[model samples]
Target: MPISQAAQRLPDDAVYVRPRMAHYAAVSRQIMAALENISPSVEQASVDEAYLDVSGLERLIGPPETIGRQAKHIIKNTVGLTASAGIGPNRFIAKLASEYRKPDGLMVVHPHEVQAFLDPMPISALRGIGPRTAPALRQMGLERIVDVRQTDPALLERRLGLRLAQVILNQAHGRGSDEVQLHSVRQSISKETTFEQDIVDQARLRETLLWAAQEVGRTARREGLQGRTITLKIRLENFKTFTRQRKLPAPTDDDTVLYRQAWALYRESGLAEHPVRLLGLGLSDWQQDAPSQGDLFDTPSHPSEHAQTPQRDRRTRLFQTLDGISNKFGQNAITLGLRRKT
Candidate 1:
């Protein structure tokens, strides 16, 4: 049901009817613990799903079916929530198997039956096949998963482009990577806000962009990371979203630099005439902050010297100081000059 419909259905005595992040996080921890007990090599697919490598544990835990049953039991016992389990030779098969018997059930696919199991399924059942791309596949007379294997690669490429065609073809063949990566590294940090009403004022939008940049910078610094690409996202009142990004010559955790790049991208978007419902800023292509080494061949007239002028260096130090003060007190303890009242 829609959120509005769900709210309407709520009883008069109900306290709240909404999603809760804290409760979700707590439940995720319980689920993770249950998976960890089954296998040390576990990859978290999402908040509600995970992949576990239990290849060598057959002797200790019986067959894959038994293990799946155990996992379901553990999750239910620990988290008080029923979970579906999928056992297969690879991640792709396992994912599909899980969905085959969802909401407290288990499905297992053997290695020999992989092709037979997948061939009968619709092309839309394959991963990465969404509403937009499904019609394109059907247009090419590729309706079933088996149709992709029969279709010419060049023809598929012409219809869906090369990368997507290759991916779909690979999945159709039941050839998927099964590596269960245990550790996940952080890739990007972002902040965004949706206004209560569409904002036509360019000044307010720019201010919101600045605020987003500040939040992203703060998070990046806290994580001891810097990024090369800065992205700006704008969502118009009509619900159309657009994004623009700029790649910096060097990674930076500076909020001012992030804001300037985001501002440039926002200007390039040409959305000033359009009322915006949402604004966002993001930083990616992360790099760790390493100590800089001075070059022995550095010259007084070098371009690098001009790039790091005394004024810019002072401003950088000032921002660093402001970050420190903000950390000591609170986020609202300091404000940039641009944010000050005239």
Candidate 2:
């Protein structure tokens, strides 16, 4: 579904950085919380639907439907959001239940009822079945779930890869046995912006990069980490997009380095030529840079003793002198004229 269409079906007025993604992560969390008894269960997945398991939770919640109704109520009341819940013997069944009526509905599949519940749903309803695969199945004359189930397991395995073959056959029979790994490792943090108006303004663009750098830096420092790679992403008015990245000389938590490198890359990319509709920045491959005690001037260095190449020494001294001058005065001590204008 188009993001806007899918979003309309959601239970809440959730805020999303990307309007088209139809992401309602916050509202989804609120709905999960309203489910009182099985609330302790770990939330498993957050795809188009959530695959939450409420199997053994019956004893605490009076019944599975009790928890389901409560979850629905919470989504409606507290979150002003709507959700459909599927209660089943396992993750797969629950996902199937949620799909029965998408955009605010519920389904219950008791262990004994799993088969009857699954048999009627189309193959496209199964999680991994894609549009292309569904068409291929139709051409092969295996149009329904039962057809997939009745096909020789070995034949299905031969046609699809072994793993997919087993999964498809299992779904056809309303018997999916995917192990739930409640814990997943964190990878990276990213932020993206869709501009109100596509832009070619260099000054505004530079300010945006600076703002992003400060935000990313504050987050990284607060987490007690530093990133080695800074990435810049841009989408143009025509919708063509590109990404560029720069790896710093050393992993630094310093905002100055990240923003400088990111800005340099943006300029070199010639993105200003195309009015840009979106921008994104990401910091990744993080590690702890040693805690900075103070600035370069804070560390004591003796100017009295000098024993090195005079030419190299002169350049180093010259650079430091210029830096001191800028620190005491202002950055306009050095001026870079704009070679191009928007």
Of the candidates shown, which would achieve the greatest lDDT relative to the real structure? 1
Q: State, as a TM-score between 0 and 1, how close model 2 is to the true structure.
A: 0.68
lDDT of 2 by residue, 46-148 (tens): 5334445555666876688787887777657876767788878777788778778877887788889977777666778776788767786777678667678
Q: How accurate is candidate 1 locally (lDDT)?
A: 0.81
User: Taking the tens digit of each residue's C-alpha lDDT, what string does model 1 give over 159-270?
Assistant: 8888998899999999898899987756788888777677998788778887887878887877788888888888776567788988877778878778777877877778
Worst lDDT run of 10 residues, candidate 1, spans 290-299
Give all candidates' CA lDDT scores: 0.81, 0.65
Off by over 4 Å in 2: 1-37, 47-53, 175-182, 214-229, 245-258, 284-342
